[model samples]
Target: MEPEAKWNGSSDQVEFSRMSPRSQGFTKLPGQKTCGKSVLLFTFVLLISAALWGTLLFLFITRYQEIVQDLGKLRESCVYHNDSGILTVIGQLQETQLNLKTNVPQLSKTLNKLQEDQTTLKSKASQFSQQLNRFEEDGTAFRSQVLNEKNTATQAREKLQEEIQKLWIEFQRANGSICTKCPENWQVFQKKCYFFGKEPKTWAQAKYACINLQGRLVSIKSREEQVFLNRNANKKGSWIGLRDLDIEGIFLWMDGSSLNYTNWGRGEPNNQGQGEDCVAMRGTSGLWNDANCRGQQDSWICEKLATC
Candidate 1:
């Protein structure tokens, strides 16, 4: 509150005033109001641009990371899928091997059975071959034996036939005087030949009478002689070929020859309790029978001593 001072309107004072904000020139500066507005606008624009750029860079990095992560996950998934596929392939292989193992024993058993069957067939074939060989051998032996037997039989038959022919010829040559019966005065000389037409007598008496005359009763050596004697002997009875003087009462011939010829009638020479020392000729039946000796007889033949 000082009292009124003196006023001096000088140039310095005017300049100073003008420099102050209260000066008119300060107020009239070009675009001063719009400068603050322009600064604010520029700041806002820079901030907005920086934020947009940062956002864009962040978005690009995030998108790039996401793509990279997705690629990695895809690779991992591919690896896992490949490993799983390999494992599956391995599992299939193992199962195949297991199946093969399971069938091996059965296959071996089948092979063994086949081998056994082959062996059995071979054995059967061998047996059949042996049987065939044996059959052939037996057939050969049998043929040889049959041939030998046939030859032997033929030789024997030929020999036997020759002997039979010789015997028949000898029989024919000897049959003339030896097989004939003679008359009363006549006498057969050989093979028990005899004469008839004398008186009948007991066989024993006839045999004694012949013996006293140095002859024997008629003794036969052949069927022809027996037939001749049977035809010539008298009807009552006469001496014949047989006598019982040897051991065990067996009949023998007076000529010391074997009694090989016999023509006994049925039931004849069945010696009774009485002695049967001589043989008698049966006239009707033309056979011989046993009888007692020491009976009478008529004419008889005396056997002469052999001259040769």
Candidate 2:
């Protein structure tokens, strides 16, 4: 059957009635057009998404290459600084080793010199000790020799004293055996004899007369002899043996003996007139006076040993 077609008042739409089966299958439906439009819009959106992803990937690759180059430069700078510091430390160690080598020999020489000085001091000390020992031995020997000499001198002196004592004893025994006596006109006292002359004579004449009688002028030895002579003087001035004929004021006995005792009167024997050289005993006072040897004449006394 044939279908009827009607035109509507719209410009793009048409209405159709029932048609044959073959024509109906070939004609486009309104719902099929709408489905095609939707598929086109979905394809356009997918293409835009793919283009934006491609641009982002290209920017990331370029920035990654630049970062890798900067890291490489920094690592090279650090390696260069480490090499310079190592070389400086090695140079300082070499300088220290050279200085140690230069100083070692001088230190060794100073040590050796000190050892030599110590040895020399030890030698000098040993020599001093030996010399001191020798001096001590010599002192001991000298003291022993002096002791021996003193003992020898003492023994000789003792023997000489014994001999002198024996001789004195023998002399006394010989003198005692003799019967000693004084002359007829002489007086005896203490183993000595004295004679008083009454005739006044010069000192020289009196001295000669006494010598002729085998006697010397009286040399009074003690107070006892002087007293005895004084009594027998007969109250007259008598010449004694004392005189200063050799040197003025130095009285000596006629027998050449030293004058040990004196009985000088007041201001007497004063070298009177520088001419009185002979001594006389005053009969009244028993004191002695100096008189002129040749100008004055006086009575004299004589002395002699007894006949033994």
Candidate 3:
């Protein structure tokens, strides 16, 4: 039979009596079972979602801690590397400074020495320039003096020549001949007189002797005069009016005339012993020889214009 269902107001429940088997099966409804299954499934899904979120949160915290630690280590390493690099740079800079300190003084001293040497060179150059200037000035003055002396010598020689010509004319007019007679012991040739001395005297002595006799040492001009003097020389070495008293190796006559003719022997005027400065005629060949002026003694010849 089917159970009758009644509502009990005091219990607020539904009562089943004399229930059939079909009604007993009706206690568990299909909609209530489906609703319970749906609630259990939703609870299980919520638990699984919570567990997954906790796990993900733990992993994230752990990774964050590891990253913080790695950052700290990197900071420390960078600080240490920077400190080491700074120390190395500081050491190098210090070494460079020390080298500069060591070398600066020496470099300064070298520069100073160079400056001093340059100054000394400039001073020496200035002194040399001054000396050269003085030498040039002195040379100009010497040239002027020499020119004046040469002009004076030329004028004196011309005046003396005019006086000699006048005297010669007067003598010729007085004697009624082309030439006056010469003094005794004097040989006459071509309007001139010559005297040969026998005494052996120094060149200075012979020169003075001729001057005392109002004549001069013989100056042989032409070939004829030379031959005449040679013939009368008596084959004896005699002093002539040729000498290099002023300058060596430059013979000039006593009257300041340059040599127009020379009759020098072989290797003559060698200035033997650096002392021979006078000229003499050789007795054998009539060729000239250089002799010592003050040290040698030789016979001499004198010459003068013929007089009335």
Candidate 4:
């Protein structure tokens, strides 16, 4: 300061010193030894750093609010989609339930119908079984009846064969020499010709019947002849040639021969009040009886010479 003052306080220097601090701020300061350049530089840098940090904090706060808003929107969207998904699942469940409801009754009805059909089949099978059993029993009975009938027929055939054999033998013995054959429905015995009447007739009618056929009433002359006549006659009595019409208590034959053979029953030939005068032989016993000439008798026997 002394050095500059020695230069005789020049007018310009004095004026510069009297200028304001604001105008000469970098130039000088009161009681400041020298200018603090490095301190100023450090202060400027700190201010710049504070301003940059304030800008970055403002940007971060603003972006954080925007991000929170975006998150809220996303949460709403997720909730809506979840609700829709749940509704869809519920709808599907309801559809499935409806389908089951519709089909269950139909299936149940089908099952019941099948069961009924099975029961009906069982009943039909039972009925068929019973019918089969009845048929079997009927078949057994029919077979037994047939067997019995067959046995009876066999026995009857054997008896018929025996009778035929006897008849053939008798035929041979009776007609060996004459070689004669009897008429249809007629039986042969010994060598005599006989006609046995099945219908009833009066004694006189019987006599006439025999005469019409070139024969006469049978004259039983011997015991063998009586037996022969009895064997051929039917169940009832038959007219003979013997009669007492010419005289009471005296019998004569139709051929004008006297009655030589007699086989009267135990209580016969009484010649009751009606005046029985005709003669008939009992078919069963071959005994004699005196009956009325006009009375009806079961049969009559006619005799003729064998057809020689």
Best by TM-score: 3
TM-score per model over all chains: 0.35, 0.43, 0.47, 0.41
The reply for model 2, stretches above 4 Å from the true place, is 1-175, 178-180
Off by over 4 Å in 1: 1-184, 189-193, 200-204, 294-308
Instruction: Give lDDT per model, in order.
Output: 0.65, 0.79, 0.86, 0.79
Model 1, C-alpha of 74: deviation from truth (Å): 99
- Model 2 Cα lDDT, one tens digit per residue, 1-308: 56777788887987876667887799899999999999998888888888888778777877787778877887788779978988888888888778778877987788788888888888988898888888888878888677757645653553455345445545765777442468989988776688888888989889888979877788888898888888888587988888877678778786555778878899886776758999888888889988888854457898776654
* Pick by TM-score: 2 or 3, better one: 3
Best by lDDT: 3
Taking the tens digit of each residue's C-alpha lDDT, what string does model 4 give over 1-308?
22223234675554332555555667856546434766788899999999999999999999999999999999999999999999999999999999999999998999999999999999999999999999999999999899879856864664465456457657766776453455545455565578998789999899889878766787777888878778878768999888887579888776555767889998878998789999888878878989988899999988754543
Query: Clash pairs of candidate 1?
Result: 204-293, 205-295
Scored by lDDT, model 3 comes in at 0.86
Query: Which parts of model 4 are misplaced by more than 4 Å?
Result: 1-185
RMSD of each: 36.2, 34.6, 24.3, 32.3
lDDT by residue (tens digit), candidate 1, 1-308? 22333346764542221233344454556678789899999999999999999999999999999999999999999999999999999999999999989999998999999999999999999999999999999999999799878856864664465456446545765664233433345555452224453756666556566656545565567786556655665665556646775443688765555677678878877775567666666666767777665554343323322211
